[model samples]
Target: MTDFVEVDTAAGRVRGRWRPTTGTGRMPRSAAFLGIPFAEAPVGPLRFQAPVPKAPWEGVRDALEFAATAQRGDPGVTLIPEPSVPGESTLNVNVFTPDPDAAGLPVLVWIHGGGYFAGSPASAWYDGRNFNRDGVVTVSISYRLGFDGFGWIEDAPSNRGIRDWLLALEWVQQNIAAFGGDPSRVTIAGQSAGGGAVLTLLGMEKAQHLFHGVYAISGALADVSAERAEKFGRGLAAAGGVAPTVAGFSSLDEERVIALQKKATELGPSSLGSIVEEGLPLGPSVDGDLLVRPTRESLRAGVGADKPLVMGATDDEFTMAFSGVAKKLRWVPKAFLLNRLGMPKGAMRPYLAANQDALERGTAGIAGRLLTDRMFRTAVLNIAEDRGDAPTWLYRFSWPSGTFGFAEHCLDVPFFFDCLDGPAMVPLAGPNPPQALADQVHAAATSFIETGDPGWPVHEGDRGVVRVWDTPVSDVVDGYASVRALREPVS
Candidate 1:
């Protein structure tokens, strides 16, 4: 057994376990400090409010296991595979470092993605051991999810989950040097909702100077307007038979609050069949304080212009959303398309002209392409284009999974973390996934964290360059133009 190592943080001293690197023979072992609290427990009076810094403890606290995670559904019920480790102290952070005494190491703070509803840092796929082996310190954080995190509540702080992330970053800035990480060399990254959080943070005035760079993988950028957010909050409050305030939510049992939140989400209009899908039900709110405007607007106005950014999405991001009956539905109704996407007159001609092969495959294939372009591809492109003076690098995860088929959403996560062998990734990566690709991806990410460049040309000029991750990684120019043109008129 490896020896136990202890590190002192602002809150207290904690002991962590040392584990050797397994797959990569060249890397060294790492020290893992799990379930370290970055904030006070968000229960009781603290429930719906923004996170407060964790109080200092008297003795050495054990950081051996993961802290309780934000509440989520049973693994069996959800399509996404996630860990369900329950506890009161859900606002926690886990750290993996090569040496607690080493100085000047780059740090990567990872925010987990779960559609702004479900996900935890405890999941095996987020292990940072490999990053430690690569001479970087990796920190994975957990924040409030579902209603507790993003549900709009009257009298409660807006974007509480995002606030939690900011606190965690602050903790890292103040304490990471003890673990051999340079506080100034921090890079904040996440996938899916976490990716959205990174974008949201980039636009947040308070988040400036917290991190040097940003990496958003399969990052989603969708939020409701204030009016819509307030309506959703009121609806959830009614579902729970309580006032739409922190006082009412704090009085209810946590489980009841979760159940009512789910009920409220389900009662909303379905995104599956609708042409004009409702924006994400629970996510960062466009509150005047935390977010002055939409994320795209904020970026266009020079938010995070000084921070280098690396962002990308899989080629088939929305295909995973179609399953069971939805998969069989295939094509979206023509009327729904005309009304929902606001396709201009004669738009179909060009879309079909550009995507004849998808049309031949049936509605499902076409719907998948449209959904991907609408939901993720276009949003990412818009963010990239609006990033102003920020040096940006873009990528596309084009390696299709054997089991899931196509380059599905989140397939690149395990590859980026170099955790393809993780059990939670089996269904997504299939067996015998390529390690060579993982090596390249991880190397590039580490390079970005260590330096500002990701070894790709900066995204500028009319035809921006993008690195495509596939069996044979290559670069593509102006790849988004076709899809952007097809969706622009309608968008």
Candidate 2:
């Protein structure tokens, strides 16, 4: 344990220790600076608007420990991964580098995904060991989640969470030089909602020049529409027995607002509840400020970011999320299924026509795939199409996990980060681990970040080639037809 020294930041000097780990065959040296403040406390007056920069402190502040994270997946809410720990001042970023004084190493800034409701940068899966070893300084950031970040209140800023993310990037631009990272060669990457946020940032004018490349894994570029966000605000107000205005909302306790958010999730897509509404709501809104417009529109218009992009989704993207829902919905009576699914009373005939002996299994599988594909695979393809001018490296994570074949949603994080090769691989990939597959994916990602190529052809008009990442590398085209069909109507 090297003794921590005070490092000057835009916000004053903070102390951080350097911990050196044994270098792997490829990773010659690695050092991590645990918790560095990227932004000031998002408490008191700075609770709702865009994040304000931390004021320069008078003396050295400790940056040795990880700060508390935003609230995520409390017991009453859904079962998504929550922050291991929670608190108010969750706006912080952690950095890892091979050399603290190495002038201008390429930077890889990561944003974690937890449905925009859960997840934290502190998750073991997000550890930046591999990136640091590969000669790229890595940084992971934490932002607000759930109601604290996403809840809509009139006269208050919307998508405060995404704004928090932008603030972290701005912090990186200003301070990464001290840690030997090149602010000029920054690459932004994210998983799930983080991936979605990555795409959103790419299209925002204010976020231009902040990054030179992007890596989005299993994220939907097209977020909920603005009209839907207003409906969600109404729903939350109804749950709390208050109006949706900022004044009416500020009177309610944090717990009360959180309770309404939980209720919104439970009601789900059909009931116009919250984030998962049937239409569009509960996501980064086109609030005309933080999120200037929809991601699809922003990309199509070619607003600002023109950097190289590496974007992809897992093969079984929706299975993990849908499995939980299918377990409960499978038991519903067939007569009730029609009404619940919004199909006519005699709609079972078309269902039977489409699926013969395994109607239930087929329907569940199709629905699950469609859900994940629309939210991830299709949206990514749409982004690629609009980003025709930008160098694009497309991929499909196809290594089937023995535990959950084809590797369900969010499974690629550990693999690409090189964190799943050891003991932790079993729980996620099962007893008969696919080490060969893991190695292939890891190499492809590292290569893309280091160089410009990911060993796959760039996606062109009709030639939509994607890197089929598995035990061995191969090229495939337009394999996600079902997902394409589902989202074609909207696109």
Candidate 3:
């Protein structure tokens, strides 16, 4: 039988449900307080503003279901599954705890990824039950997305989504103790754009002391300049036929705003040539306030020097992203491919020698590899190098998803959450994925949350050791040398 429980939060009394543990007798059951509002709904006049704390409710608000996601396009187009629910209070968090009465347990806060445009905490793969069973209190959060969250508006706060993240962390600080979590022992983590969020937060002074450590999985860093942000915002306003301000956006119907945002994003590749040429659009911007500089520079200046961190990307971070597009590029000329990839014709010599089949496959494979290195892998390594003073553990998720030959982006998420069996994970993980890998990833993550270490030597100086998560997991120093050598310096 499911057990129902209630906890008094800063906002009001919330009713939650308890799901019995499916583990051995030693494992503890977990309580789930879902759809707990951490901030006021960013709707109507509040839209595009920094998150405000939700007003206190009267009594016994049902916290039994996931909240609605921020406005987004259909999720079917993305590799990761994004389940949408319906509600206005998208600035909410889901808390899973071993025992609501227990105190001082470590807390793990998760931010879901959707390319800064889509995704929600309601995805089945994000269930925090396994975390609770392991004696950790897990909190998964939802924030604004797409134009509503990241779009730059003249009258609205920049990085509103990031602001939502900070507000949620503040909420955790204020209320997690009642859910059996120690606010002082918080570790924030995210995958893909969420992972980017982790790194972004690390670089922000506003995020100081919010969490003791962080995990960035397949993190992709994309920061737009104010000029670029304003240009994109103006274009979005033009597309929507509204003034380039929060008031104009607020006056439009919510669905109409979402539709226009979708159109703007779809036009990003052609309209926002500067960012699209670099394979990025409508993400975090250097707003000169919350994020005073680029994230890498901020880290180099010691923004996150005190926190322990675990950061890495998959071997083929963009394999899934390139799957369909690659197939269509088979007939494209090699010279054009070389030019587009910023590599001279003979530059393919080393890659060709490494993969004999690359020639037959044309530039698709090479392009995917280059994109992976430039967009994800190099960014992660750069962060590691800059934050060398901190206790940082690096990793490479090499286990391939059966659907894609390489370790695709978002593939490691289920393993990290130990939710491979979640309904939405089957296609990504395949049936009968290696449970052993899941155990190793989950154990290491739980260990990090509890003690700020992930069972590996700290990466230091030139000889940075990296944990390779694959069959027969092993550690190697400077494993990224080949790709790093080929990587162009960040612009």
Candidate 4:
């Protein structure tokens, strides 16, 4: 029993700590709450705009420390690392709890991936303490990455890091009910660009209702657009020698435009690389004021958030980013197999005649099943066959990491943040007792954040029931039919 509290938030009266652990066969009593801002501090004229509301503070503040970011590549440069813990209101939020009054529980939040450029939610594999001992509250957010979060500064304001994650889910819908949580039962998970920012905040419309459900691991909603994120912000303003106008690039030198975005991600897969499928040199777009469109045309016009969604991907999402540039590059295996299959000439031959033994793992298992079925199993089967009144759920972690290679790409994020016994979950899920697939993907992600039903069912089509996971718990079916027959569509 260790207590420390302070509420009244919306950006103030902060301070927190509240334990109750008493279940220490190893660890428990959760209820933590480190570093709680939510926005504000883009520094000097709110560099590149969008997230505003973080101003009120007047006392109590503490929040035990966890703030200071955004110099993390572009927007005045620096590429992550130099902040053992600096401060200046880095748009924070970190909560974990068992019962601050534990009302209606079920709130997840999360959202930390690094391809929008670098990561942090005070990373320690995102400590949400075994997801608040499984009753659930667990939040973790902190936006603004590269080019102060997804550069694209021409007329400015494109995915300002997906509008700082929709104002941190509108500050978890007006303050996650004083930390007991249940803001209408939210659930917005992430991984790998925070699983494509949880499928671009489930096709946001200001992330309607803040969030009702969604898991989106692995992430994809392809090539974001808004005129190709303003032509990748005019190629990141011609790699920082400016004049691409955000008023001639806000007086340049945000670490020399993130050291020219680490010299355009070391000039490898340019369009200013570091993954650019749907435009924008940084990430996230459609940008009619913070991603209000394109998530494959809002999941084929069904518009998002029908609710209860869960999603999956890993089965090698690009073998640890092409085994970290395969011994320092050389590529050209036919232009790295046609720019990693953006397709050309022989249109990759129906994905090479449906995997003729995946060309000897050269295309790292067909570029990890075409980057996990075009960025996450066809946008989770197009938001699970376009909402038949929601209830999506889909899986395919296909667990293959006895220390590297299948449960790849941010591997089920420390097995649903139970800290898969951290140390980076043994090169992705191995090295001594991961206690049965981290207690079954943290009990199916806390039983779908406590009762959205994650035991598996809704994914109708080819009867593929998925829940597979490891250490035994079957129900498989469509387990990569040659990566969903190379994601069909080739008429």
Best by lDDT: 1
Candidate 4 local lDDT, 1-491, one digit each (tens): 44777777765787677665422323367757787777777777777878888878787877765677653422322121223355567787888766666578888988877677676777667767667776778888888877667766767676677788888788888988888888999888887677778877776666777888888787745445666656656887776666887666788856777777677655354432235354325677666665666665676576674667778776666555565555343344633744454543344666666656435556555554555555556556655666544567778776677766456666667767656555545545568645677678877888887788787776776545666675576767765454444345454
Q: What tens digits encode model 3's per-residue C-alpha lDDT throughout 144-209?
A: 887788888888889898889999999999999999999899999999889989988988888998
Highest TM-score among the candidates is held by which one? 1
Better of 1 and 3 by lDDT: 1
TM value for model 3 = 0.93
Model 4: lDDT to the true structure:
0.67
Flag clash pairs in model 2: 400-406
For each candidate, what is the lDDT?
0.81, 0.69, 0.80, 0.67
Q: Deviation in angstroms for 349 in model 1?
A: 3.2
Candidate 2 regions off by >4 Å?
Answer: 1-6, 20-27, 72-82, 267-280, 322-363, 421-425, 481-491
lDDT of 2 by residue, 171-289 (tens): 99999998878899888898888888888888888888788788888875435667777788887887788888776777787677767786677644354212222533455778787
Better structure of 3 and 4 per lDDT? 3
